[model samples]
Target: MKIENAVIITNKTRLESLIERFNTKAQAKFYIEHSGGNFSDYEQEHFVFKTSLSAVVEKLSVHFKCKVIDRSYLPNYIFTEKDLPVVLGQDGLVANTAKYVNGLPIFAINPDDSRYDGILLPHNINNFEDQITRIVHDRFVYDDITMAKATLNDGQTLLAFNDFFIGPASHISARYNIKIGNENENQSSSGIIVSTGAGSTGWLSSVCNQVSRMSETETEIDMDWDEDQLFFVVREPFESKHSKANIVSGYIDDAHPLIVESFMPQKGVIFSDGIEKDYLNFNSGAIVKIGLADSKAHIIV
Candidate 1:
């Protein structure tokens, strides 16, 4: 599509390398999200370097022959909904930032793939020049992946790109009162996971013991959940004092009345899109609903 104007958003270390590689044509900016006392690795201590991100922005502006704007200038650029520019960030920041910016397509760059999962990332920064050129020149295609929606008991609704999980916050077992349309399932188990087609490969696979493929059709609203049907996996039922770990698998019609009971008292949390959204209380007739959302995520291949 011939990107005459673009913005470069990245973490500190990768910014230097990205600027040295990509030749900017028109307008480009570098944004650095402040990381304070946060360690990249769990074993290492958190430390901030002496060089600020602004230095990298200035250097990149000169090197790439583009205008380098700071994070403060983002609001000015984001004047209208259509003014949403292509953003580049690490895999971790892509989905969340895209959601915040009202569903902008984030081109995730995998700086180091060995340490973490880079499944969503397009390519490593080593091929930054070629990949960016291809993206700008309309040489690649992007897909809009469907997202899942959940409504809590308190009438709070949220959207998730990956999966929505309802489970115990602590290590103890928990219960969930679940209802899918008219079919009711009272699950007394560790938790429940309502996953999207995109999240079929992750935790849902481990729980259901089956790999899930991405949905080909846009907004496939099939409620039929068999071995082949998509939108499944309600697992790790709560074990009562007299009961065992009851793990059930079935379609929407086969999902029976679910009620989870745990001896250990703990708060159960609901996660939207792999992020902790809210907490649910074990009360009389507390209902948790799971379904597909109308929104979707645009993905570039």
Candidate 2:
């Protein structure tokens, strides 16, 4: 497909966020310095990010129409097949932008390599324009990353490029009934995390770390990024007279999905990719099915 436009996705810099909170840059600097923090670090990070973003805009503008959008607008942004997504941020930004891109080829550029561990970013400002040129010539290579999806009985759906957290909104035991294949049980625990292969090293890895530390044994759960299967773990499942912990961790495939029914009267939620604000209410009477999404994130590697 001929690319007609490039949508550059970005996020507010830390300095910008501090300014927004304190109402001015000088006040933000005063607040940070007063708290024994280095205000110049923020300034330097912001400067590097802006410089990288400017370079990205300049490069893409030469070959295609370019428009920049903040990360906050991703949920409602309308993307087309002919529109190439050029993300300029950390690895998490690529995960955040993947859900809304509808499988468009994403060319992720690491804006500041010194500040970010860009696991998903394969290009840097030094060599990104060459890849863009290849993309314009229809010779760019990409990887189709699998993603997880949670669908409610009410028809509401949420996609996760990394993982999904299902539990109470607040810090409390999540009450729910979980079913996979034939087994079913009522459980009270911290929450449940369903992770795609692309996210096995993310939040899911921390959970694995905890298990390995507690059991004194190494646990390996990583998988291929394009694998169709997904993994889920029940965090801190508690066994009681009314709740059982037998149904804990398991794998979900296309033939079998994980079904959860909320028993919490209020504040139960299902959020993806660590964005708590973007979530679906999982209160009483809500049933959600977690499985592999039909779409994938086509990332330029």
Candidate 3:
């Protein structure tokens, strides 16, 4: 079998959280126990992740050239075409990493299945060897996942495996000019959420849930995981003399993209997949166009 290089992406465990709060494991244990925080649960969770990681590393090393990396470094880290990413986390982490990975085949591995309902994670510690063997031999199936992209007038672009949040950085109201298809409106609200198929069941679903609750009639929309189109929902559009709320929610595709012009003078921001730290400025004079990206996530199945 031709060996392909593999990148194992793992995140920090709860032990890091314990260390962060108390500065040491002993102090963390003391703090947790004294506060009735169940230190044993933390210990068990940490042990399980460490064991799974050891197994993954040991197995992959025998098959291909592999390296382990932390989740925090995924943004700055570069991925090659021949590199297969083995993401060891929950469904959200898959989505987070997918945005930067381009079209590389991602082997999603759930470190602890009992703790997570990983919709995107198909492999675990026990069954990962078989999956890795197949991947090395070029025998596997993958799901094509379409993602959303947002381009600013300044030439900066943001990609979302799940969705994009465009709004104010602070608690104040956000002002923007929204264009959906041919209709355009000046909207004043909280923000706008543009979603892809991967995000339809996530942030997009919450918006739909709220809509269902507010309306008297029942509403249902079929959202398939590999769907080509995208969805956008404007949050809390206020009706006034200058701002309109008619074109608040709609669909976007190759033919029609969601466009927005920022009216905010300061603190306006645009970020993808709920990662707030990585974002672009969307203050006044910024025009952002959100649509489907040419890149897709190839998840090993």
Candidate 4:
């Protein structure tokens, strides 16, 4: 692809969030100190992130037209095919950006290596320029990470780089008719989590850990980041006179998708990548098909 513009995706730092909440930096600092929290940690984090971001912008602007957008505007922002996305923040930021970038190659940077684990960010401030040079020459390498897709019968769809949550919007049990292949049943549970290969180590792994501990046995929970299939687990399936827990978990592929018909009167939703604000209503009369998506997240390695 001929990349001519660089779109930088960013998220609000802790300090910025605090300031927004308290209406001023001084008030934010006072509130944190009153709550026995260390305000300096927030300040330090903000400084490091700004420094790194400035350097990234300077480098990208040398060759390509640059534009920056916050994480909140991702759903409404229109991205063109000739744009390269430069993600500079935590690993979750990268996951959040991938869903809306339309499979564009991402140059992920770790602003603070000491504070963030940065599993998705392979580029640091010092070495990112070399990768930029490669990008300028159209010689950069990338890895294709698999993604999960949730499609509603009404034609609305949501894509996830990590996983998808299908259930109620509240603390009550979710009611739905779940079908995988020929096996199908009505289930009442906390919710259902469908995990992509890149997301197996996240919420999916925690569920696996709990099950393994309860069963007192070892279980394999994670898969390759680029695996074609997806794993799903129904959380806390409750057996009742109206619901059955026979189909609690399974793998979803191209041929056999996990289909769910909602029986909830209200408050049911389906959201991806833990962003509950951006979701599809899944109340009664809604049927959703969960499967592997055709688009892959192309991250520069």
Candidate 5:
């Protein structure tokens, strides 16, 4: 559907955060300076982002009716049928915005090319006018980025752009019964990270790097963004009398996916893309079904 209204998604910069904490820009600068922090650095970054945002918004307003929303408002904002989402921030912002967009084709716009590598963000302020033109004419092409999903036993499901973390909310051992194919185990680990091709490099790469450095096991973690299957990693599974660590990491294909039953009496959580605030409860009786979501993110590459 071609949307006439564009929704520009963005997040607060460091300066906004500082002002939120101290109630004013002057107080924020005062606090930072008194604490020996580089206030000028914050000012420069904020200026760049704000200036870039103004330009992007101005360009977008000339083409379509634009509605700018903070990244935090995505969860509650009801997206209309004619809403066009233009994400303007870091890769994390795109990933964070992707799950809530309901499969709207995203125009990933990077406000500042120098600070962000634009992995998820392919377009910048210098060239987004063309992308918008293409989008307006329904001539834009998009890639179907695979997404990970976690369905709770109570029928609640959560979507992830990059990955999903199933474990304790705090720094504690997460006890769960993991099932895959004909194998199952009662394991005690930090948690499990389930990722799609879109999120292979985000947290999964870090886990792979740590494994590559610390161990001799050939725990290869590689994924294409549009792969049908999902990859899962059980973080630091410990071997004990009842807990096992054999089925540590593998692919979660159609036939074989990860099923984790929470054994933690409390504090068990299921969150995605590193957003700990937005999560579903997974207590002792919860069963989280991990697999690919029915809908993929249509990202304009």
Candidate 6:
């Protein structure tokens, strides 16, 4: 592979070491994404580290004949849809991968082994300098994994590489009406969780227990009800007689409708890919459509 311009991204703490190493071996341009506190918070505790990182970037730019840009410049510079190879810090790997970038292989360097889990990383920062040449020049395999797409009542659509959860934001239980295709299913649970294949190992496993019970009686179940498509699990619903949470598991068949309604006072929150996206009101008949996402994450092995 021919790499003319190389962008090196790193956290604030590891910027100096990475810059020094890059300057000694290669002459490619470098860029850093400092992992300081959010830029908006002026009184954040990590201001000192942010300032120190800025100073390091300036010094390295003059020494290595490269330009140093902040994390804010990432959208404008790093993700330009070009076919260039991008080396990212561990944090950058997770953040960017969630955004769904096509055609570019993002190589992540794990800075600390004990601090974080480097499940998606190709190499550790300790030995990355020595193996950098081999990785950039060789052929690597990446897995194309699908994501889940959800459309809210407001016509806003979002994609999740993991799972989509709809539940109460507080201690109160959430009540919602569920419909499969044109048939309105009985409402009896707290909330519902919908997950894709990649998310099956996460919360889906626990939720599957509730739905799996139904499969025992029916031998000739629909193939779409399998683990690959969508899994629906109900949470604890409000009951006047009994104050306990109950969960039920089921899958949405092909062309079948799946919908939920909230019956509690508290607001319902929808989490996409484990991150909170929007707050849903129960007053109106808000419909949330869930399905498979178009893009996939290319995981380099």
Ranking by TM-score: 2, 4, 5, 3, 6, 1
In terms of lDDT, which candidate is strongest? Answer: 2
Worst ten in a row by lDDT for model 6: 24-33
Judge candidate 2 at residue 258 and give its lDDT. Answer: 98
lDDT of each: 0.47, 0.95, 0.87, 0.93, 0.89, 0.51
Rate residue 203 of model 5 by lDDT: 88
**Alpha-carbon runs more than 4 Å astray in model 4:** none
Q: Is candidate 5 or candidate 6 better by TM-score?
A: 5
The estimated TM-scores of all candidates read 0.57, 0.99, 0.96, 0.98, 0.97, 0.58
Error of 2 at 148 (Å): 0.3
Residue 81, candidate 4: C-alpha displacement in angstroms: 1.9
Q: What value does the lDDT take at residue 248 in candidate 2?
A: 84
Worst 10 residues of 5 by lDDT: 216-225
Tens digits of per-residue lDDT for model 4, 15-125 = 999999999999999999999999999999999999999999999999999999999999998898889999999999999999988888899999899899989999998
Writing each residue's lDDT as its tens digit, candidate 6 over 29-94 gives 222224443333322323444543354334334323334334434435544333333333444344
What count of clashes does model 3 give?
0
After TM-score superposition, the amount by which residue 299's alpha carbon in candidate 1 deviates from its true location, in angstroms, is: 1.8
Deviation of model 3 at 171, angstroms: 1.7
Instruction: State the lDDT of candidate 5 residue by residue for 126-221, as single tens digits.
Output: 888888778878889998899988899899999999999999999999999999999999999999999888888778988998998889776566
- Predicted structure 3: lDDT: 0.87
- Give per-residue CA lDDT, model 3, range 166-231, as digits (tens): 999998889999997779989899999988887888887888888889995565555666788898
CA error at residue 103 for candidate 6, angstroms: 7.2
- In model 6, the clashing pairs are 175-262, 175-263, 176-261, 177-261, 180-257, 181-256, 181-257, 190-236, 210-249, 211-249
**CA RMSD, predictions in order:** 11.2, 0.7, 1.5, 0.8, 1.3, 10.9
Locate the minimum summed-lDDT window of 10 residues in model 2: 124-133
Off by over 4 Å in 5: 216-218
C-alpha positional error of residue 158 in candidate 6 after TM-score superposition, expressed in Å: 1.6
